[model samples]
Target chain A: METTHRSVVDAQDTFTMAREQALIEAAQAGDKQAYRQLYDRYVGRVHALSYRLTADQGLAEDATQEVFIQLWRKLDNYNAKSKFSTWLHSVTANITVSYMRKQRGWVHRMFNIEGSAAEHHTAEGSAGDVDLEAYIVRLPERARMVFVLHAIEGYRHEEIANMLNMAVGSSKAQFHRAKHLLKEWMGYTDE
Target chain B: MSKFEQQLNQQLHDLAKEKAPQRDLWRGIELGIEHQHDTGTVPQNRHRRLAAVAASVALVVSLSWYGIQQTSVPATDHPTGQALVKALSNQHEQQKQALLVQYTDAPAMTENWEAQLAELDEAASAIKAALKEDPNNGALLRMLQQVHQQQITLIERVHAPQWQQI
Candidate 1:
């Protein structure tokens, strides 16, 4: 629970952004110390997203490690046009999703033998007691991925469709499915 | 949108964006990156190092046994050239078996290594025969040692071609 956010102090935005770009440049030139500074600044954000998407802490930890390892090699691909955070978040999301998909076969075969309920996670706490994070993990797998990408991470339906390799309609359907299930679980029946 | 829907949207926006994992993850990241870069070399280099030590140990044992046998010979009695050849041949056979067993799994660069070894063995036999006529000749004994050394060197090279000269 490292709390990091963009500066509320708009006056410092220019200087902060410049320093960030300088750090990125140094890291791209193979400065591991600079890369580490980037890692410290960004790891928490990456971990949170990874955990939300995978719903498994160990998998999230692995995905987070892979993200930075991939970043070190692909640093040069950072065109620096958009914010580096935006670019890196996409990278993190892609790697985490890919990691999950690699396990998808095992998940698929398991569900074939057992019902989907066996694979589905349910938060033990009552709706009022449990936090949203617990509830997020309880959604159906594809729906959870869709909702986390679209609602929480702020990727649009089209972007999520592309990310998840589904039709745009399918992405929206899954998001609606996720939102509907979550609202029902949280005791918000009135729409 | 319903008030609840808007509330949910706001909650999603306000959701914690950063969650620190229970453990530090940088060490693993560093190792992963370094390991990828050294994927072919690191473990292979370690295996080579281990094999080099084993080869050296085998050679040392063989030479030590040879030394003990040499000392066991009575200084007053003139040990025949055949006796010295027998000792050298026995040590070479042991060393060759050890070297071949160590390198069985590895590939040898030269296909005709056995033939080359046969030629060296033939040369050693000829040198031993010549030694029969001249048991006291220093040059013949030196030549016999040289032939054995060449065979060992050849075995080492063929098995571990990347090995640096010892």
Candidate 2:
């Protein structure tokens, strides 16, 4: 059954791979149509990642636009060594983290926002609103990024480290710190 | 690290698995791209209209100049050069207008590529600077490496051989 499922998935994967290749080729050749098709394919995932990072829908939308624009121009560089999604995720992660860093500086400069450890997470809301995302967003910026990519995105620490430009140890530490912070904030006395 | 972490991971995954955003941006993106392509080419009617206007003006000026020359008018006083210069100026203005249309219609094609590249450069620079501030910034270093790899790949693409159409 797994083989049958695998075969089906593989067939779908093959189709997707072919489509990605065609789009990349066209985009590299400066075919705006192909570039737009590719953007349509991944814009949501990128936007979701951005939203998770920034915790602001508006910022996420802006970052999503910015990231895709970057991806379109940089499509020439994508060699088929790894999956295009992985390369895209790397770009998304880098862009979002960069945006977060800039936001941190901006917020600090514009307003005297200081780093604090205590956060009161509300658990009583719609499933969409009161969820792990809210908790993840409350993590310190770097740790939150690591947590989202690793725990959420299922990337290994090494991959997370590479994507975030952090040490594996730091990535691991951040994930733990994020989890601990979440657990504390949610008042998970059962744990 | 614990069952709590495991649960947290599951919860995070569930949150992430929410439906992706609507693909309306795709339509906007496609329109933007088409607009760029349209602007890149000169509209035939506009070009032809300008050409006809210039020709008509030149015809009138030539008729007047011929009449003046027949009257033994000084050649230097003739506005032939000025009229030709004005026609040339009009042609330049038409070209400029076409360029402006191309630019305004599809701004992404006009300026976003460089802006994206500059953004990537700034990202790379930030990672490097962060690394400098904390030499053991493994996360920052790893990100820098990815950025470096990406930057190199982009440069290669920009310099890559253009594909030939059959």
Candidate 3:
């Protein structure tokens, strides 16, 4: 069983490497089909990252497409510099933050210029009542971004600061504020 | 251990895995590249220019197989027109320099006499050449007339000093 599992893992690894190489070559050659194949392979994770940060389905989809378009235009810049996945993750974060800033069509920008803003983010539960997702979608943009990156993506506050161009302390403070807002939104009473 | 944090994290997991836009939207990207190639814009790849050219030609052929043909200007004609325009512009500069050298003592009346004439000539030649292939093209005819009028102005500039000032 162990030997079989090892062979399976090896085969899968080799397949993945070969597939990635082929897609990269095709994308370099200006083959949109190869780019689409690559988009299919990574877009799920990219969407998840986008949706988590933005909490808007439409916005997430738009960001995903925009990200891939950049990937296509900037393929030569990739340089195998870091792992493709990490590079993609960085792109996702950058795109999501920009989308958040541009939400509401240039009016009532979500982030407040005060000390901090608090907001909620939730997952799945009963649909009829004010469930988790509805609450999360209401969070102020910056705090929500920090919370999503910290809790969902498991990034440290310093890393979040670098991605967001904010101070590490500010990122940590925003994470707490986001959690506090979620507490308020969820109506989780303390005894 | 706040309930909000737990719920938010759960919601995030549910949210992250949702469906994204279909992959087919990228179909337009390659089409855009082909359009650019056929329009005779220089390909950007410097290291593998031959490969880029071959790939662009292959793309045009393959895409044509699917009934999406590029406009039927011969490949040679497209590049030659582009090259001719470039060469004529260069020649216009040289003509301006030659006129300056030849007519140095003749004129102070018109500052850009040579440039004006060369531009008119270039424009007229382009329009005349275009109208030969596309006689019924109203746009080409209008352009040709515009070039002819422009050339008349250049003739006036060239003779301005002899007739008016000196």
- Candidate 1's TM-score reads 0.61
**In model 1, what is the error at residue A2, expressed in angstroms?**
30
Task: List, residue by residue over A89-179, the lDDT tens digit for candidate 1.
Answer: 9999998888777644454565462213412443354434436787787777788899999888789999998988999999999998888
TM-scores for candidates 1 onward, in order: 0.61, 0.53, 0.52
Task: Give each prediction's root-mean-square deviation over alpha carbons.
Answer: 21.4, 21.9, 16.6
Docking class of 1: acceptable
Report the CA-based lDDT of candidate 1 relative to the real structure. Answer: 0.72
Model 1 chain A poorest 10 in a row by lDDT: A113-122
**Pairs clashing within candidate 2:** A77-B153, A165-B139, A165-B140, A165-B142, A165-B143, A166-B138, A166-B139, A166-B140, A167-B138, A167-B139
Model 3 Cα lDDT, one tens digit per residue, A96-168: 6766564433334333342223322443333224455555556777787887788767789998998878999
Q: How high is the lDDT of residue B88 in model 1?
A: 64
How should the candidates be ordered by DockQ, best one leading? 1, 3, 2
Candidate 2 deviant stretches above 4 angstroms: A1-6, A114-118, A121-130, A154-174, A185-187, B17-166
- Which pairs in model 3 have colliding backbones? A120-A136, A121-A136, A122-B11, A123-B11
Off by over 4 Å in 1: A1-8, A110-130, B40-107, B110-166
Predicted candidate 3 versus true structure: per-residue lDDT over B4-33, tens digit per residue: 556655666665344455334343333333
